[model samples]
Target: MKGLLKSLLVLALLITSMSVAAERVHLGFTVHYTLKSSAFSAKLDRVVVTKVNQNSPAMRAGLFPGDVIELLNGSVVAGASARKLDAEMGAIRAGDTVKMTVLRSGKKVAISMVAGET
Candidate 1:
């Protein structure tokens, strides 16, 4: 009986956590990067801008492929993983402004874009 009660409590908690994750908002863009190790580690060697959807916030903000992302909202992303970056972006809601620093052709550029639904 004690084991059954414990199992039920754990199941309930898992359901609650799943529901919360389902409510997260989309940041309307996809980011791809090169990781020297695993996703669990914060060791991204390069953040390559692979795609920018048409009419999306990133495209509207002039972000294009071949641009390397350097910072997010004033935080350095040099060693941040793809998952970590996705989580940080996922936490933002639509209409929220995201400030990003990027590198293009050896030049550093800063851009601010509003988040939108995918």
Candidate 2:
């Protein structure tokens, strides 16, 4: 009986821990997004295009470094890193189609893209 109680307690704790360990998306500033139901959000930021790879897809797609990614795959690009963003950009490889929503010259621009080496 004691062992049974201990097992029940451990199972209860495990279930509680699993449920609470989930990460809920929160949008704070950087293009805030809120909704009635639980949602996930990513912040947006301005980035400078330092250089464009020679003969790469970005060049072909007419994307410059100064262009900022305001939205990625329909999610706000908050606290996103360049390396991590590749996946968000759709793991695009040469000849693969990708899309982007960006803010350039104070205007929202959307571009169809293919991934290329940086």
Candidate 3:
């Protein structure tokens, strides 16, 4: 009985650890954007941010709803889709710093944040 209890405790601890580790893989944020064609330039596209997740890295970095994300890690995200953004974010690991160039109320802003778990 003593050995069985010990084994069960170990298994439980392992399961909890695995769960925490799995949860830590995500960056803990959500974003919404609309693609728009530039009026001045026919071929230019824009990604306008509509929301920023609460308590997320985005929020921590001073990103808010209505902020337009222009670049990710210095790379342009003008025409990037949600899937593309996800791919970019997916490539980043926890504790990595994410640099962003954003447009807020017609003013350009730069921000950085350390990625963290959801």
Clashes of 1: 0
Q: Provide the TM-score for each candidate, comma-separated.
A: 0.69, 0.47, 0.62
The per-model lDDT (C-alpha) reads 0.62, 0.44, 0.58
TM-score of model 2 vs. true structure: 0.47
Maximum-TM-score candidate: 1
Deviating ranges (above 4 Å) for candidate 3:
1-28, 36-44, 80-84
Q: Which is better, 1 or 3, measured by lDDT?
A: 1
Residue 94 CA error for candidate 1 (Å)?
Answer: 0.6
Off by over 4 Å in 2: 1-45, 79-90, 116-118
Whose lDDT is greatest here? 1
Clashes of each: 0, 5, 0
Q: For model 1, what is the error of residue 16's alpha carbon versus the real structure, in angstroms, after optimal superposition?
A: 26
Worst 10-residue lDDT window, candidate 1: 11-20
Ranking by TM-score: 1, 3, 2
